[model samples]
Target: MIDQELTKIKSSTVLVTGGAGFIGSNLCENLLNNNISVVCLDNFSTGKLKNIQPFLNNSKFTLIEGDIRNLEDCHKACENVDYVLHEAALGSVPRSINDPITTNDVNVSGFLNMLVAARDAKVKRFVYAASSSTYGDHEALPKVEDVIGKPLSPYAITKYVNELYADIFQKTYGLDTIGLRYFNVFGKRQDPDGAYAAVIPLFVKQFLNHESPIINGDGSYSRDFTYIDNVIQMNILAITTTNEAALNTVYNVAYGDRTTLLELATLLKKHLVSLDESIANIEIKHRENRAGDIPHSLASIGKAKKLLKYNPQFNISDGIKEAVNWYSKNL
Candidate 1:
């Protein structure tokens, strides 16, 4: 945060929707640390209560056990809030492929509900969690915000719809909004157990238990594995920016680099070996690639740097080390 804007942010009461999830809980922790009042809303469908349990006693923190799919719940959560950080959504491409209807209901319809609530509440800005999956089938090396391809999965479609709705909400309802298209975000508090668990944490969990992490392809597919701290900075910049040009737009939150699946597994094992020497001898395994997964994904963070002054501090290796350390004790 900029020194001048610190006071305004500290005094503001922000609503974090999905505040019990990995990314949302981290956002809550950072905001509370900065002396900001936070109102968290969640249905506990995907978000875990243990993620936000530590903050339950904080005087500045308020928890609303509600679902965004319900309009009344959205409206009620938006009450007395200065800004809305919309992080609630049904994530995972496979999950969406298995249940597209439920995904659309929560990701698209529920997003619309939150947009309506934030608009009516006259919140200063609505900063939301967009996804790199929105890049879709675009076969570009470095994905930019403007150059998007046709969505390959139901989850990608829902996230793209969010951008469309966010744009319309800005034009129609005069609600200032920012959409953060996050890449593969990983770090502390990220759950490693679930049917649709993210790759990094899931691999960490498997390696911790000396189990093989199945890589879909020949371990060649790569991603711009972003650290959670960088994502938090992007959101903070979105809500705290004073520049008019920075408003009503989307930004790619990533490390501006790429790491192949084999490379990622290697890095994880190297770091994890420090905790357990036997992990160094564990064999990394691979399998057939999943459908609709692109070969590689990298982001051009130039727009964020120029507009939001975003400077990501962690790279893939550093992020892996940090994440490995966390999983060593917490997982």
Candidate 2:
């Protein structure tokens, strides 16, 4: 889609709200690679300076240190921006469970602030990161966008509220919007040191150091485990699509496959073994299941493929191998 679809945004300027973070930094880098001017707004709460440091010297890349929880910051970031890719949020089930107040402040209230700023700025499109957590207690395989269950956690509630606010923003204020429900996005630059670190990078880091990585449950739980590039494709398509029917809706951004926790850990170990033979001997351990944790998560990407031409290029094996390689060298 790069030489074709992404060409549409080549002349446009994009504002990545969390451009110092993992997924946001990747998006910012991709846009800058295409010679598209990018303005990055981040407070470095969960974002890191190292992530955006490489782009600091680029003339086309601009960094605005600001928080999404502040409306002035949102307004300033949206100014003269052609499109907004909102990726700023507090992400993690346990984090929200520990402090629902801060989660709602950033995810729900901050999301609304961005919506209003985007509307007033008259940006062409507002594309934000939604999550599969919205699938919640719904016991279904290959989660579809239209169907959803009650939120299983405070973080899930906040993300669901983002979708609702986006929908109302479009209907009430004529602001076009699209939500990409990201599933387990992991890749280079993803932090492995946080208490809320995602499973993939965290596991890869532990294996690199010959530390046993813990599985939250008895290893029966599963996830779609999407790659960062697939997510980048979905975000680009969300902004560039000319399909009138695609706007004001949500789409699942995933590789459309699932891997059990046991399978995922084994996959990580297998790939990291190449870096250090000792990594093979590292044991995989398990404990009680995490609260707000679902047994499985899978996404049906039919909506994205049909509407946005989103074709995921990485499967679990391919994604894990790439992630392991990057972390081995960078982590």
* Local accuracy by lDDT, each model: 0.92, 0.92
Candidate 1, position 288, lDDT = 85
Query: For residues 275-307, could you state the per-residue lDDT of candidate 2 as single tens digits?
Result: 899988889999999999988999999998998
Task: Return the lDDT, model 2, position 215.
Answer: 94
Q: How many clashing pairs in candidate 2?
A: 0
> What TM-score, over all chains together, does every model reach?
0.98, 0.99
| TM-score result, candidate 2 | 0.99
- In candidate 2, the residue pairs with backbone N, CA or C atoms under 3 Å apart (3 or more residues apart, or in different chains) clash, namely none
lDDT score for residue 305 of model 2: 91
Clashes of each: 2, 0
Q: What does the lDDT read for residue 121 in candidate 2?
A: 94
lDDT of 1 by residue, 1-331 (tens): 4334456677899999999999999999988888889999999998999999999999999999999999999999999899999999999999999999999999999999999999889999999999999989899779989999999999999999999999999999899999999999999988898899999999999988989888888988899999998988888888999999999999999999999999999999989888889888888888887766778899999999999999998999988888888888897
